[model samples]
Target: MDAGSMKAESRCPLQEQFLQRKNSKENLDRFIPNRSAMDFDYAHYMVTEGRKDKENNQAMSVCSPSKEAYRKQLAEVFNMNRTRILAFKNKPPTPVELIPEMHSSSASASSSVQQAKLNKPRRHIPQSSERTLDAPDLVDDYYLNLLDWGSSNVLAIALGSTVYLWDASDGTTSELVTVDDENGPVTSVNWAPDGRHIAIGLNNCQVQLWDSTANRQLRTLRGGHRSRVGSLAWNNHILTTGGMDGLIINNDVRVRDHIVETYRGHHQEVCGLKWSASGQQLASGGNDNLLHIWDRSMASSNSVTQWLHRLEEHTSAVKAIAWCPFQSNLLATGGGGGDRCIKFWNTHTGACLNSVDTGSQVCALLWNKNERELLSSHGFTQNQLTLWKYPSMVKMAELSGHTSRVLFMAQSPDGCTVASAAADETLRFWNVFGAPQVISKSAPKPNREPFAQLNRIR
Candidate 1:
């Protein structure tokens, strides 16, 4: 009895030490190791350690495909990877090879293959008409998508719920990154002209600025809007926001971003805002049908105390405004255009000049560089986009094809494209088709009854 017991005790410590030494380096048992050797019950300690590890990692760890030997077990857990996929042997696929259908694959299995395939140097395909030898890199079916031109990268916002990015060089609708804010809906989003940051206006009256480059949200602006901020315009570092409660806020969009002042004069909801090309003054239009111009050069305190000019025209709600790109003193109103009524105002005097009859309610307004010609879009029902034809007020082209209410319209910075976002869930591209092909006074009608009856039989 004495000899056998002593021999067993002696073997226990050596075995335990060897197991501990093996585990400390194998990368598997390094996370969990049995330490007790005096009890000669190493299985008990193993069970205890295994239970602890499982309890700590139940939500994260997954069993590894490798063998789990007597002294150690292999496990994997979800983790943030600092090591780049780019460092691997495989590169990302070329832009031309990225097909939307590839996204249907599960990320886990596809990611590794995708990275390798993308990183691999592409081989030029030899072009041929009928399988005869031809020059390489001359394939007819090389692929690329137009959306690829807008933004190569995107910033995820609202706790990784939404994304926002420039779609292309055109300053049209920002790729609207939607966040699951319980369908709270975003009232407005303003990207700084420099493209550094984006300010998102939430339906809950809270404002959040996302740092695009860092891809992490910095902070939130509380007490947001009196109601949700409806319009946001940026002039360099200063942000002017218009809200439903008739409160126009002047915010300092800096690292210590805060509301510097609030200008309250609009009797009803403030609907629109525009910064003069010179950036010295800001023009805002509201539901009160009044246009108010604020001189940005005024000190923050003065801004709140000063009430610039009260434009007392436009009998109905002043829905939209855009400053002339060339003329600092001129502003265009979109609510009323043509015979239906679009108002062009002299920013300096706040006086309405030349009420053009657009034959439809103005839904959006945009000005080109010289500011002589005004491009206006009417509501979705008629789907007419008219160019004021400069000082002449003649009708230009009337664009069609949008089936639902056109909710928003924006012009690209280069003036090469006009984008309209509508309730039909579509984005359309319209440009200079040149020369009118169709004409209508109010709405579309077949020239059948009167004109056909009078016409001679052919």
Candidate 2:
């Protein structure tokens, strides 16, 4: 063959093969699937399959030869495959039920919670007096404070012109001293805070001091009060005396010039006198229906008046005065028969905090040391002792035994027992302020030692 013919023949075979490959690629393209159908059409088909299945089942039931025959045939096919594949392979286990014991414990816990919600706090009720003693010839005078309980557990009372000391431990009585009839009867009696000395106020306006243990007259504080001395209070070494002269004198017992300071505020007789526990303030009530609070600094100052607060809220005479031991600024004062009210004042601001109409003549007021309670002695219709809750002023209990008015009440140093002397000539001991006690014979008795030596001037 010729060279040109051979080359032409080879080129013709190659072109044929290329044409064949091109045709094969076009054929495969027609059979292969597209991603559009797989992504969009397949997802739409799956979402609509449930509705289509319901329609198909309904149509198949009507078109089929028999519905029972179709279901039985499908069940037979599924049962045959059940041996190779299990149903509900990923199902969770069942939860266990609670036991009977656990149910009972839960119910009990709920009941206890309910019970605690229904409980409330209860208040305390004070008891009545434990015992009573005869105080024959006890002078029933409203202006006089004749009953005083010493720290040594001895109670001193003035009956007529004689001063008697009653030992509470032994239940025995002894005469301390007696004044002449010409010098007048004892108007008031006060014991020193140390329990060693006793102050006797006479109707003749003479103040006498006596050593309680030795039973000897220490000295007579003279030229202090012109009129009858009705009240007396001891503040350490200084003795304070208030009298009908409407004057309050501060006498230093250790010094010769005992009349150190004199306070004048009331126009009527000064009847009530009390020194605060801190010895910083002095409260005095008078027949002028006035209450005065004095400061300790006034004694050393040159001011004309040493009165801290001048209160005039009472319409009648104010003979009952008591300074609160817990609150220093609180002061309580009771009016006479005409007013018949108990007034509480704040000494700091000179303001009246509260006042209660007792409905009867309030003779004296005593605050409990251990509890927030107040005790009041009354006269007239209800000649009894009423224990009241402070601030609220609620009457907790009413103790009635005395036929006459209770004029004076004195608390022991222990702040438990109280001795009340009434017009019935009886001195009753009440545990109204504290709990009852049964003192045994083996208990160590309180020391009856005498106080430090005083400057005796016979």
Question: Best candidate per TM-score, number?
Answer: 2
What's the count of clashing pairs in each model shown? Answer: 21, 0
Q: Could you give candidate 2's per-residue lDDT for residues 1-458 as a string of tens digits?
A: 99867754644210111112233236554344444334344345546674576577677877785874776588587542122221223334343333323458777676666556444334344454556666666777888888888877888898878888888888778888889997768988998867878899998999988987888998888998888888999888878999999999988877667888889898989989999888888999999999999988767624445699999899888999988879988988999999999999998889999999999989999999877889899999879998889989999889887889999999987787787889987777787765644556585654332234545644
> What is the C-alpha lDDT profile of model 1 across 1-458, one tens digit per residue?
69857754654210111112223236663232333312224344444664675464543434532223311333323221122212213333335534334455575466667668767663221111111111111111101001111122221122112333434433222334554566345666566664556677665666666555565565666664767666777776677777778888877655354678787779877767777868788777777777788876554654454667877767666665777766667787765332246777787777777786666666677765433567776663485666666667776555665555444555544454555544433445565422233434565442222112222211
Off by over 4 Å in 2: 1-128, 301-304, 436-458
TM-score of structure candidate 2? 0.70
Against the hidden true structure, what lDDT does model 1 obtain?
A: 0.54
Candidate 2 backbone overlaps, count: 0
Candidates in order have lDDT scores of: 0.54, 0.80
